[model samples]
Target: MDLTRFFADVDAQPWADLHHAYGSAADIPGHLRALAGESEEAASEAISELYGSILHQGSVYGATAHAVPYLARLAAAGHRTEDLLVLLGGIAEGGADEGDSDEAACRTAVAGQLPLILARIDAEDPGLRRAAAWAAAMTGAAGQVLPALRMRGKTETDPRVRAELLGAMAHLDPPGTAAEATGAIGAHEPGEVRIVALLACVDGGLPWGAAHHAAMLSLLPANDLVQDRLDLERNEPLQYVVEELLRRDTDADRAAAYTLLDAALRSAVPEARAEAVWAAETACLLSRSAPERLAGAVEALAADPADVSSAYSLLAKLGGRAAAAVPVLARLAGGEGDPADRALEALVAVAPDRAAPLLARDLERRPRALAAACGSLGGGTSGTPFPYDAVLLDAIRARLRGGGPGGNETIRLALLLGAWGSRASAALPELRSALPGAPRAVPKALVAICPPEHRETTAEFLTAAARTGPADGRLPAAAAVRELTGDTGPLLAAVADRLTPGGPAVQEAARLAAELGPEAVGLVPALRSALSGSVGERTSPQLDADAEIAAALWRITGDPEEAVPVLAGVLAEAEPTWMRWTLGRAARAAALIGEAARPLVPALEGLLDGRVQVPPVVLALHAIAPEHLDGPRAAALLLEAAERDDDAATALEALVALGPPALTPDHRRRLTDLAERDLRVRASGLEPGIAPADERLREQAREAARGLT
Candidate 1:
């Protein structure tokens, strides 16, 4: 496969001036030569370099347009044909700047080589045929490519190749995809081919009828057969079906999804049943009724001893909503080993009160269950802490007395005892005995659990830790000393030292300095130094540190000179696409400055339309420029953010700041609905930790509604 014609004018082009992800494109010619060389090893390395430099992370560059023609020619000559076709397809998908001539040129260059791409769709190699199908559709020359794909779909012999052809047809002609897919989903086609056809129907927005649903259920656990040969959206067909149905959010669509999943869960095959259970978890994350509808079915699976681990994980994610599974979980918790511990964890998340006695009974054997109880019940703002059972407290005391708890277990024990506050005074001697081994974790617990008579001793111990302990323990110790003795002397000096530029704890130090107010007047120079020391383009953390320092300086010195400009810059700058939390921090600092932030009103107003930005922007405007705010606009945005759970607590706080007059009758009704709904406002994705935060948001919404009335 000689490439003399392909490289005829490659060197005549000025590759140095053109740019890729790696700056100069001067090395692109060598990579291109090596990619077509005889050695397979060199070709592999060269292609990887080309992907890194020219099409880096899916973003095409100026040099990518120039290289597309050569790539297409190499692929046609049957040299790494499949790999080159895949690369050409990716470049043709337009990762460059929208409407840029370079992006247009890249697409045009690929389209010009459609003859080569179309020829490979009939190649003897199934892999080459699949790649050719994908590349042909990506060129966007539908007038020419669609007829060829429709022709190939009729005669493709391999099931995998047929599935690829169906996907390509769906991409080119969505309205026509349903008709083409219907023929492919017949009894004659293979299981994987029918599954792809079903997906194509969904992708085309065709009405899903009874036939389609029946066909999908017959192909249970198609995950094994529907290999990701073409890099389709999801690897599991059942999961893809459930997600698409629930995303439509219509009652009829959801009903159809529930029927299919319910049948799959009852299958006797272990793998099929497990896959169905996994798909049900996806449905639960998407739909509010999924936990209630599927909980009993999942609980039935828990009856089997071997299936308990997977069932428990999903049940724990369901949280209190899976109350029906508590009986089954309770039975499993009585046994021994990892399954029992897992059952206890699920029980703790579902019903902490009932799980407490069980935790007390097996405290020595179930470390994970104990940790789950501490994590789920110990830290939230709205829920009750883990109840203090006499048996549980005694077990903890035994562990401390015998010196059995390790570092992490010791911390958990301290936190559990601290939650009981003065009620746990009976265990004070044991806590003190365990203190020397875990000084950093124990002092905070000691200050919380100790009575007034013992506070002086605790304070003395903290003072010693503050002055001479490890770097990680010093500031926390000083903070505890201030909490116990009301002495700022230790904390003030600690804050000044931690506020040094490039320090590890500058954010926390600056926040503590703000709490000291005028007492921190001596630390203004340090605050100012940290504020201006950001290098290059400010990153998210750098922006956050600046916000904290600015707030500290304003509180200490009451001067807007240093504080206002940084806040203004944060407000005026483009929000980082990655971190949505940075602007909220800056908005909070501006709110603290109050009237000094008057100059930032326009910048904050410009940020009103963003969902994540609304809560903080509303609060900032309320503090600095309330008269200029459009109450209805702020209220609508706040309600939208609250509904989507984009920082629901902050949105409710903004609602409170907007006051009752901002909320119309409709707004109040919606707010009441949010307060009283059984489903959590923030339930998205698979994070089980959001349960407590959702409870907190619900309580805030209830408080906001009542206060408004």
Candidate 2:
């Protein structure tokens, strides 16, 4: 275990010039040395430090590549072998920071130690063998690791090690793995081995036949037995399989995922059925048929008290698409407690019209349903709110008058009344009564629920709040006043006063200033002062503040002199995936400047390489300099992004912005396929209003395709 020879040149390696996530790598060698020390506690602390710095959050750096050689040597010498190997595996697999050269260096460093790693694949210790196999695959030296994994797969006795080896083999040699996957997935293999082999068939692009489906059914609930030593991070095997199958997004693939889950749902075993219900939720997001085809089976499972929570969750995620399940959800919603609350929540999301009457009956008792009802209003068109039901409106009014609901429930009540607009004018007295106790929650609702006759009084109250309210309450109050009265005079001073604090408050103030247009020219100095802060590489409030200020400046003054440079700077400095929100704002601001922002075209085009940037960049280019875009290239990128659930809505919006001429015959055909496809595009992101977003994307795709016609 002597590391004297390995340490000979470690200190001389010019660590001062390199950097990791936290900056200087000079301390990296100290941690490396501590990792080889005898104190297990010291080694653990040292490894944690290294993970934080070098391979921080699955991102490799220059220092990471340099440290790899030492780590491989440590593992070779049996110093914390299992831990070091996993570290090496992480480094090998991590995506390097944008524009960093460490990705290749890190992988090559790991591959250079393949002999040491491969030697441990046959170790007497199962844990070491598993680690060795994972590190080998991540090396991505397929020519070297693939043959070794294939050889080890023949004799690996430890079931977990065998599973790990099979996964490694699949990673290193998909075609070769596909050729052998069927035999490994046979009845004779252990369940874990079969699971990995089945996944390989899916991963290797093998035609998933009847055998694969049967194999997966038998493997349901196998997730509890999986140790996941390979660090695959797939907690649910069935869900992983379903997601992968639907991820291909082909008509055939979606059908395959649907059929598999549909059959699993029929399993008599509650555990297997539960697993299928979970996987079906993902399927619902990726495939349109999933909700209709699987909802009945899920509803049947929900009859079991034990499974109702999970079933209700799935139905809720389906949103309006799970309309077929509303009757069952309604029956459950008629009951009481957590299950009923959950069911009513699902019912509210699935069919608000049906949920309204049910919610009115149990409004005070069903907090979850009331919250869901309130949240649904924020999803789409603010003006075209959910159709107000007199029953629900009366119940909300009664609850507010009773004064029992407080905190989030009170907020929810206010939001529900606000959504009904002038129709909820009767609740104004209740809202006004509740306003003093809950100042922040009630103002926006008051603005929305206030009628024209009462608006002047509401505006006066809000204007007073803007001038003299709590620091956190001023901007929103002022914005509401402007929205109702169309007066920027009072709001202008509030915007200037709030701009100096510099967070979300600043961002909101800048947006409010922009809404004032030429009337906001008085606040341009404050907006410029807000932009005077330092910029960071990633998205931050300051970055968003800069983007908002720049856009506001141009809108207010119609001068690109101050705004254009800040927009260009934001576009240039913001990192793609990490700073996407800021990048998008910068691009949209550039769109506002139009051809005067022409100098930013290249940066905006570079931003196109990121999925989050594509939508805004496309729209920006079309607005700034559409001729700079290569129509086919933009079409190809937009189409690829459209296939992803998270990006589809925005991507299609960009695709439509490209106009019909950008679409070739093939692009048009794909657009038609997407518009007509059962698989949804907008169902994957973390947004609360997924159903509305998905439908919007669906319609956008159809409109884009129809435009071509």
Candidate 3:
């Protein structure tokens, strides 16, 4: 508790080299120093930033551990007990979106500080007691913390504090605590108090599958990512909240949880429904089957004016299981708004049969709806195909022939026709004629709609648009000319003549040329010249120039040899503030080189020092050299990285590549659990936005672990 001694003890660690959310923990010393300085505003700001960085969202980083002992000292010396306790609780929880190993690392970090934290659980301040109680639960210091929690629960007069203590006690799962948990969460308790008690009860093996399951039915979701109306600034994402619950729910409460979620979905308030959506999404992940239990609620909400858009999204997430919503979705599709197309997509997802007629009728009634309708038709040609291709194409052609179609509408029609590829070939001449009016979009449309021969002259039209056609249209024009023409020579000439030295379309021209890849191998020198200035000195807008130039060099040369040294040197030091843009492109180029990038490994490892953009840096490592983890320092990071859900499979593959000796029992268990979840996620058809590559990575991780198990 001696502040001076604590500061010296903490300061001795090489804090600068540690990693926080954005970058190095080097800046952390300055913040901690400010906390002990005179400025209250600076101290408060330091605290706020700390929450975002070390304990970002709800995930803990290695720097998080390094900071805790110092923070514990600060709290003990009475600098800021209440807020510090709250932050300690969150850090102790680590990142709920990850596996147990990651959380265990967090607990391990705080384990030595338990006596200091536990002593505060029964403090005089109710808020301090409440926060410390939560922290104790999170740290799993049941032996030291539980007795204090039980003592505080029985005698604490303040309802909120007592409820928090009860919750912590329940989470520890001692004798007679179930009855205490139920009592604490009763109607007499406030919603906030009930939420704490219920989560603990659920965590303590209490089944939420009971018909009148109080825990699931009550407790307004406070997670910032899911609910509104609450403090949006501080909540962990819904994914984290759900993972925390599912990971702890040994009670198999999926069915009853679904029933509660159904009720939450129908709640009149939007925020409540959002929370329900979070729970529903979690249900799909945990159940290994489609969440049809919430179908009726989703169907009912699909028509609710306040809920329509989100409801359609939920149904779309349900995929083929929510077939019951088709009629409602079909009705909703005819109505205009953002939700309408989403509704149509949901309808297609379940019942493409009914969706076809609905789209056809809507197109007939609303010619302006042509783009949205045609855009919906094939859904990139991979979704439900254009069943009524004849009807939809006829409507698109008819709308374009009209004397009054607006420029934007014209562009939409042309683009939709282009997306059809060969299917819209017959309309090429007409599309070509319309190019004079809406030249910018028509050419890109022609790129896809017209045969290469018919579209060759369309580049001239796009070039003219690139010179004028309002402000925003030029980039699209240059992009289109580059794509539609499939000819890089003229653009590279323009890149030299007009695009460089700050022409209106300079960036776009360079970007378009980069797409030319090895075909524009001649432009390598020009591209390399653009990357000369110090990357750290570059601003955000200027960073794009560096990335494009780097990408162009890598793509055109089929090697990163030229750009690698410059990019690696730029990223070699503590990254500049605007470094994410450059870092991503650099890592990408390094990834292209793969194992050949051995020389660049040390530089990428510096970025993975648990700082900002750790994922990409880790990915870069995975791409360049999974074998790098065989070294001691990188190997330790790999074990922790494997515990993260996002980083898990990739990290597992890396560890497995190191062979059976590196594969521990804990690692194998987490791997098996994640593999099972990936299968469930794929079967449900709701990636929610995860790439298909994630599933492939999951499979690869399993194959890598095939023999070790």
Candidate 4:
């Protein structure tokens, strides 16, 4: 039984050997034990061979399984246990990484051998016990090893051994529980022990460890290690525990507690607050109501205005249950309060109708509050118009006339114009006067308000602005043009002209022309000409303009002949794969424009033939003419493609489109035979290489045959 020779033979054999070798565990360990008793050098060589083979190749066999049992027997035969443990540890660690069932079985065997080894540790010298603990830790079964270490910690005579046990406990709870466990070790143990205990308590939610929370907090001031632990906990969802400590603990402890709590709330998600709310509700139910918990949160909001946003978000989730906090909200929203502006904004968001009248009156007194109030009224729960619209409009107009330093007046004017809708026709003179200097956002609001007859006037203003305003103004001006013209040809042409030197403005104008419906038909030639001229520009400043114009042309003419070629060219030339796919789709979209695109059939067929795998091409051909295979040449080409390995699927698809009338009886029979052959091969559990693709091709041929029938 030369182990090296045996392993070499197994390695030479193929994977099929596994099926014939050791069928059960009983046959494995016995064989290895016999081998181990032969000779020390031979046994070690055998074990080493087995370990290397299993660890590297990950193959399982009766001989490989015997490797561990032989090592254990050698150790019992007065061989060095230290050497055996090192060999076993390496095998166990390697097996864990393999993650195969056989590797897992090997790990189980190693774990079974641990108790026997630990027994050796107890009876042997103190140094051996230390070595045994290290071996046991390597097994990674923390639950089993932790109890043993804890027992050893009680009377292990050597301080160094006890220290190693504490370190083992810390490693066991990697997620911060190590601190709590370490704290619990001796007094009682070392500071490291206490810290591990605190970590364990935080991690495991151990109520018994609550006593250490105060100590851990105190250590935070002087120790960076403790401060790190606090910071780690601050990021955890359970930081609420620290916040609760601040609230329920001594008043003297409140300041430091508040600092930790504030940091946690700032970093936490909405669910964190929900957890806090639930905790607060639970505490209030358990004891008498503690206003301090809610008060602490409210006070934090008052100290920092941004904190009020979460308070409102939390209250919204609490629904009417948070009605108790309404007075706090009201006081915060009141003038002279610290976070009053944000408070009022949040209150309207949470309960807009109830807060609307109060907000309206506040708008008159405080013009800065007017913008926030208007935004609130627009999006708030009321749905009805603002209560004091007349007063608000007067304030807005005054702000506009006064020409305030900031853009606040412009914002106020936009809100007022949006509020007016068609009813603001009386303000036409004022609106007209304000158009030139108004913020870009104002024109869109004016478009929403302007009357039908005045739409022309609005378009004139927008077109003028599009010509004169900054680059940013062009988009809103284009939108205004769309709103005014409502698919008129002149407006469509104007948008196209403005879009020629194409930027965002051109892109927006193209979109506007597309929205104009049939009236945009006039821009097709312009869009096509631009697309043609810019085809080779390498960087068509107007490529997006061309795409948008194509879309507008499709919308206006419903003619595929004019749009498909342009779209195909773009698809072929586009750099980004996604944009190429988009243009390919647009080219195929000609099929969707009704029978008018019948002329695109040759182009689509060419695209499909060119290996341009665009879905729209198939859809276009099907839509325009399903019975398109009218000639002998086309039918032969399809048949020839169907015969080729790579083009088989495409040919089958073409046949399916041509329908049954296009296929002869011989062709039909051939395709059905191919399909049946594939089905039989698959049924027998053999690999079906190109057979599935061939089957799809056959299906298409059958469809073509059926159409001929």
Candidate 5:
């Protein structure tokens, strides 16, 4: 707990020689000092910066292990350690550094020297005890961690801490957890303790029926359970056990789960019904049989307006097959609030073809629902391309005609037509009529949506727009024109003109050439000239321009060795943080360059050892050396990257290409589950947060999963 003592015993300055996320650990001491500093604001900032730097995106750097002991001391002294406890658990669970045994080393450090903190589990501060429980479990010293958690489990009075202790016990020793959870069930502990026991019983592979059902029923709500009991005879424990049953890997368990969930949906007690709603929603994610297992509950579940949202949410999770629920969802879609919005969203997903006509009805009746319905029909979220009939198209056409002169609405309509692509070319005349004083977005949408026959005209219009519109619109317009016509005539010349000494469009021109890839072969010399002049500059635009030109040349010339030096030179340049993404892109371009890239492997490996993006780097390594793909470093990097949302599909594609050595038994199982599980809510993959997905990403995940084994 003594900050000065902790800093003195450790050669803290040596940490600066090690690596953290944004390169060397030179800046670490300032942040560490700020953690215990007098100012509240500084300490808070220190906490955030530490999370981003030391444990960036859940990755542990060389500095992470070195700094763990100090963080442990800070947690012991009560310097806001909640997020820190989670981070420590994550590090212990998975080794963040692929090249080093940091997980084992950090586990050893905590197990050998952090006994005093384990004793803090008995501290008067419940928060400290909670932190201790998690830290102990993650320490990987099962011999020490289990005994302490078992002891704490008996005397831990705070139900929340008790739950944490129970969870820790379950993770540390699943077999031993059976005996402990059995005792807790019989002892009639608090709701949280019972819930934890119930979860452990299921996790430990213990029998999960009537014997443990009492614990779930014992949960006492902050409000009256008596009024709820009078309304319906229900078991709270059963409702929770059913949710866990979704994760169970057996059909019989799932059947029992569905039957119970369906019964709970009809229960008169709102609390019982609400919990059932939560369980049913979770059940849809259990496996590919989720929709079949949950099909029986949809009607009754949707009958209650309050419960309709949960039903339709599960249906949405069930994907396009749950077409039976569309009628009810269509009805609920007319209402207001989150439920209504979700109902419409789910309706669109489950039956986009069926929902299209109904959405047209909603479009005319509810202007509030119009935007969401438009999105569902053929807008941003229209996943799997369902055609809208003349009815809906006519309605939208009329609505477009009614818009004031030209607002953002006109752009939205153009985007909707773009979503429909050539199928909605009938509406192009309407869009063309509005283009007189419309924004540049209309032209972009027109380029994206119009048929190939109109490409010449679209190209000519966008080219004219580029000449006269705002400077900001020039690059996009030039890019669009290139896409439309593929005619290098003026584009190559225009881009080349910008490469002159002090031309304002030089960088923009360089970016356009890069976007055109190999087609802009004519602009390679200009890009090369731009690269030659821009090297070694510390400025950001120079860094970006350099990377862009390098990428452009490798793409145009089809040679990796020729591009490696320039790309590597950009990486070797001073002030790398600003150009890190550009550097990664350059490396990827070099990877595509083939055998000439062999010399760059040593440098690419250095990028992997640090906190730089590893997908492109690992991808480069995969393309270069098939032999190194099986190492602990390569396997760890690929597996981690293969599961991330942003990089998973692309990373998995590259990982699969590295061949079966990268596909371990565990990786195979994980991939199989992801493949077999229908993650699509309709045709699109379930996007994180509120963002909707395009159809291509949905197929990407599926294809990666299918290719795994």
Candidate 6:
């Protein structure tokens, strides 16, 4: 064989020709094999050419697949093994495919090359040595090569080569590999090597000496080792390992180790006092336990102020479980206990309902504490009625009936009503009466207590207040009413009637009406009319009117067929991005309107294809016509959008929606090739100029390619 000419020819030919040459069965075994037996320089040149060709053509070839085997034959035939070994290493690490060859052939080729590859791992050329270690690892020949590599790695002068050797050893796990791994634990090696060795030992289920265990423990900063140790020590019947770990581990490690201790506590082992405290405090945060078990800890903490903070912290974390501590919390709220105020605040914070009655009863006796409790409960009432609702309502009604709307009592009564939610509906007349000359607190309570059925009345009041009352109070009243009624018919009607052209109040009402759902259905036609009016003619008030009307209509009908065309029109006309996005959402909402929506698929596909006047509406189109669009067209659009990096998320979403059949092998190959190049360029801190959408498209392509294989 003319090695120099062969090398020249291999390099001179384009990648396509080389791929074609290697793909041909007849040219691979005999012709390529002859090149492997040439001089070291020639062999090296040939391997480099093969690597470049494989990468450029983006196809694995049969001849390139046999390169390793040819190298092995050269070694056996008494050629200088160093160059052959280096060439074999390059082939292994080159990411070349064996043209979808069988696994048995791959293993045979790898096995044949292993001895020469291992022998030259100590070659004077550091690059060749590192390449050998990598190739040995890539060929999956770790078992045969790991022991020799480990021994050499212990004293290998080059840090980079030593690291590769250790990494290679990490891949192999034949019988007794764990024993070797255990022996390497205390060896003077890189942290990476030590970590790998520890994992190997853990995987092998090898018992550790105290010294080895301590060395493994010292490597706790490596998360893998810490987790492995936790898994191992958790099953042991003794608590010492876990307890010691809790004391010595960092906060993260302690948190993990505590989880195991919690399991141990759950089992039948006799408990230690310190372990119990740690379990009670730490374990409480990780998971739930029986109320009885937690109560024991709570009572212990409550008995001593020294433990009060921990007790309170645990109670807050327990959330609803601390309901049983209501009585103690109530006592704390009372002025009698040592840290009574703090305890009371903590109790109010934890289980407000359970402490409400006590706080209300204490209000007359300890007005300051009562004030604090009322302030605590005044923020917003829970939707569920508390047990104190009837009592609180009765007290407020009695105060009203007594004809004394005087001072702090009035504020207290108002706070009580606000905290009672809808149950305070019974106090509506008193609330209505208190609206006059009553403190701002009274109307705040009225807003909170107002029923969904009275949403119209509330809207009217809010409108009047917005027109004449304090700005702060008016907005809150409107907000509260909007939240309470959702889309009640009367509320929608009030918003529509008061909706003036271009007013902030009208716009606010429109926003509220939209949030109300099917209850606002009556406003749809009005909204459509407003949207149809000229742009300059549409006031903020008119837009508000239109928005509220549209919201009401959608809420009432829940039928997209009745709404999508209007929304699509709005999407075509809306200038603001937020409004455009909302119109898009409305389109989405229409698609969700049940089987009646099947007829809208064509319209959606049209919008998606930019056949209509609206902005690119792929998401809405995808939502409605996922299974209906032309797959190839949709895929092409996705690829094009991805290439531009425009709305990558939406593009990828559309590609995924297009699904498997649309992702042909050619599409996948292009995407994978693009991604590999992009990743390399990005890693080097050079901009690949690939759009975000293309990145996702590449990922989808890679996944699709993998599924084919």
Q: State candidate 2's TM-score.
A: 0.85
lDDT of 5: 0.62
Across residues 532-602, which tens digit of lDDT does each residue of candidate 1 receive? 44444776777788889889989988988889888887665546456467788888898988888898888
Query: Candidate 5 lDDT, tens digit per residue, 680-706?
Result: 222224331122342344456567656
Candidate 6 residues lying further than 4 Å off, grouped into runs, are 1-296, 319-342, 349-354, 357-386, 389-463, 466-508, 511-562, 565-588, 591-709
Which number leads on TM-score? 2
| Each model's backbone clash number | 0, 1, 3, 32, 2, 11
Error of 2 at 645 (Å): 7.2
Using TM-score as the yardstick, the better of models 2 and 4 is 2
Error of 1 at 610 (Å): 5.4
Q: How do the predictions measure up, each by TM-score?
A: 0.84, 0.85, 0.60, 0.43, 0.66, 0.37
lDDT of candidate 6 at residue 235, scale 0 to 100: 25
**Residue range 113-201, candidate 2, lDDT tens digits:** 89989999888999999999999898888888887887887787888898888888887787788877778888898898898888889
Per-residue C-alpha lDDT of model 6 across residues 265-305, encoded as one tens digit per residue: 33322222233444444443222232334554454444544
Better of 2 and 5 by lDDT: 2
After TM-score superposition, the amount by which residue 515's alpha carbon in candidate 4 deviates from its true location, in angstroms, is: 1.9
Itemize residue pairs with steric clashes in candidate 3.
21-612, 22-612, 224-235
lDDT of each: 0.80, 0.80, 0.61, 0.51, 0.62, 0.51
What TM-score should be assigned to candidate 4? 0.43
Alpha-carbon RMSD, each predicted model: 4.3, 4.1, 9.3, 21.1, 8.2, 19.4
